[model samples]
Target: MGFFEKYLTLWVALCILVGVTLGYFFPDGFQFLGQIQIAQINLPVAVLVWLMIIPMLIKIDLKALSGVSKFARGMGVTLFINWAVKPFSMALLAWFFIGYLFRPYLPQDQIESYIAGLIILAAAPCTAMVFVWSNLMDGEPHFTLSQVALNDVIMIFTFAPLVGLLLGLSSITVPWDTLFLSVIIYIVIPLVIANSWRSLVLKQKDGDEKLTDLINKITPYSLSALLLTLVLLFGFQGIQIVTKPIIILLLSIPILIQVIFNSG
Candidate 1:
C-alpha cells in the first residue's frame, strides 16, 4: 500500500490540525493568501489544488478508459454506493440527528449552513482519491477508473439537483458559480490533463517498468500538494469552522461506517 493509503485518516487529521494552527497563529497571512484570488478562486489553494490533482492524472492509463465495459459489475457497485445509497442515507442521518436528535445542542443560526455543507459534500463523490481507496480494497483498477469517471460525468448532471434538493430544505443560498468552478478545476481539468499526459508520454516511450518507476517517484509530489491545499482550506476557515457541532458529529457517523464497511 502507498503511505497515504495505509494511514489516510491520520494524515488528514494532522493536516487539519496544522491548518487550524497556522490559521490561528498567523491570521493575517491566511487572510492575505485568501485575498489572492483569480477568476474569484483563491490562488494559493488553487495552486495547491493543482498539486493535489496532477499526480492522479499521471497514474491514469488511457487504456483503462478504453477497457471500462469489461468491468461493469464494479462500476455498478460504485454508482449504487455513491448515488443511490450514500446520498439518501446521509440525508436521513442528517435529518434524524441535525433536524431532531441534536437539534437542541446546535445553534439555530448555523444549522442551515451546517446542513448545506454536508449536502455539498454528499453530492460530490470522492474524486482523484477514491482510486486509492479502491486499490487498497483490492479492487480492479480499470473498473475503478471507469466507475470514478462515470461518477464524475454523472456529477455534472446530478450534483446541482441533489444539492438544491437537500439544501433547499434548510433554505441556504446555493453557490452555483463556486460549485461549477470546483467541478471544472478539480475534476474535469485534472482528469483531462492526467489522461492526456500519461497517454502521450507512453505512446512515445515504452511506458515500461522504468516509466512506472518515474511516475511512482513523482506521485508523492502531487499528494503533498493536495495535503497542503486541504491545510490551507481549514486554516482559512479555522475558528468559524467549529461553530456547528451537531453536523460534524452526524458526518462522522456515516463516514466512520463507510470506512469500516469498505475495509471489511
Candidate 2:
C-alpha cells in the first residue's frame, strides 16, 4: 500500500468498533484478556508497546543527534510544556471541573480514584508515541529524539515527586529504580539496538534506503498492535465512562488540553 493508504485514525476507529462489538457479544472473553496481568502491565498491551516502540526506534538518526544545538527551541518548548506547565494545569483543571462543578454529580468517593488515574496519565513522560506525532507534524526528528532522551533522564529523578505533589496524594508512590529500568528497556535499549543494527548492516554500503524500506514494511503490524491495545483499554473503561460522563469528562479535561496545546 502507498503511504497515505494506511491511515491510523481510520484503523483505530475500526479497532474500536470491533472491540466494542466483541466486548458486547463476548464480555467474558475480553474481560479475561484484561484480567490477565502479571503486574500493572497487561500481556496484550505489552506486545503493543514493543511493536509500537521498535518501529519508531528504527527511524531515529543517531548520527544527526550530534548537532543537538540546531533544534534547541523545539526541545525547550516540549520540556517546558511537559514539566513546567502540563502537570499543574492538569491538576488545576481537574480540581475545578471535577471538585466543584461535577462533585455533587458523582457517586462521591470514586472521584478521587478517577482523578488519580488522570494524574498518573499526566505524570507519565511521553515516550514511544511522541516520535510518531513529531514526524507527522514535520518536526525535526533528531531534535525530538534528543529531547526525549534528555526528558527520560530527568524524569528518572523527577516523576514520583512531581506527580505526588501535583495530585496531593501523599501515599502516591512509584518504583523509581524500576521506572528507570523501564526507560532503559523501552527507549535506551531500543535506540542502541536499532542504531547498532543499522550501522552494522548498512554502514559500508549505501543502503539507508533499503533499511528504511524494510522497517516500513513492519509498520502495519506495530500499528495493528497499538490499535488492538487502544480498543482493549477503552473497552474496559467504557462502562464506567457511561456511568459518569460529566465527571469523567471534567477530570480528563486537563489531559486533553495538554495533548492539544503541546501537540499543536
Candidate 3:
C-alpha cells in the first residue's frame, strides 16, 4: 500500500474535520454546490464517484472473471456475505435501533430517511476500498478483482430493487426513479467506460507495464477524488450534523456491527 492508503483513516478524519469546519463557516458555498443535481443525483458527486471508482476498476482483468472457479471457497463466502447477508442484516439493525430503540432520541422526521440511507449504504457492495483492504490483508489480487467484478455485475442488477424492498419493509417510501438513475449513472456507465479504457490500454505495446504505470500515476488522484467527495457530503450535511452530533454516532452503531459481523 502507498503512504496515503496506509494512513487513509487519518486522512479521512482530517477531511471530515476540515469539511465540517468549512460547512459551519461557509454554509452558503456548500449549499450552492448541493443544488447542482439532476435526477436527484448530485452531478459533482457522480463525477467524483466515477473518479474514485474507475481507477480501481481499471486494475481488474475482465478475463479473470472466468477464474472464479479457482477460488470457489473464498468467492462463495464473499457472495454469501455481500449479497445474502449485509443488506438484510443492516436493514434489521436499522429497524431495531433507528426504528424503535433509538426513535425517541433521533429526529422523528428523519428516522425513515436514516433507515433508508443505511439500507442503501449496506446494499451497495464494496468496490474501490475493497482493493485497498484486500491489499492490506495480503489477499490474492486476482480473486479480489474477480469477486469485485462479480459484485459490480450483481449490484447493477439488484441495487435498486434490494434497496426498494428494504425501504418498503421499513415503511419508507421508495423513490424508484431516483434509485434506478443512481444505479445506471454510478455503476453501469463507469463499468462500461473503464472496461473499454482497460481494453485499449491492453492492446498497446508493453501494455502490462504501461497499465501499471498509469494506475500508479492515477491512484493518488482517485483517492483525492474520494476525499473531496467526502468533504462535499459532510459539508452538505454539516448543519444537521452540527445540531445533532449524536446522529452520526448512533447511525454508526449498526454499520460497525454489520462490519464486525461480516468480518468475523
TM-score, one value per model: 0.77, 0.82, 0.79
Q: Would you give me the overall lDDT of model 3?
A: 0.81
Mind giving the per-residue lDDT tens digits that candidate 3 earns over 9-109?
99999989888878888999999998999777898988997887677767777677777688999889988999899999999999999999999999899
Comparing 1 with 2 on lDDT, the higher-scoring candidate is: 2
Ranking of predictions according to TM-score: 2, 3, 1
Q: What is the lDDT of residue 128 in candidate 1?
A: 57
Q: List the residue pairs that clash in candidate 2.
A: none
Q: If both were scored by TM-score, which would come out higher, candidate 1 or candidate 2?
A: 2
Write the residue-wise lDDT of candidate 2 on 60-134 in tens digits. Answer: 677777898977887788788888877777777677766677788766888777676666677677787776556
RMSD of 1: 3.7
Give the range where candidate 2 is weakest over 10 consecutive residues by summed lDDT. Answer: 38-47
Report residue 109 deviation for candidate 2 (angstroms): 1.1
The root-mean-square deviation over C-alpha atoms between each candidate and the true structure, in angstroms, is 3.7, 3.1, 3.4
What's the lDDT for residue 156 in model 3? 67
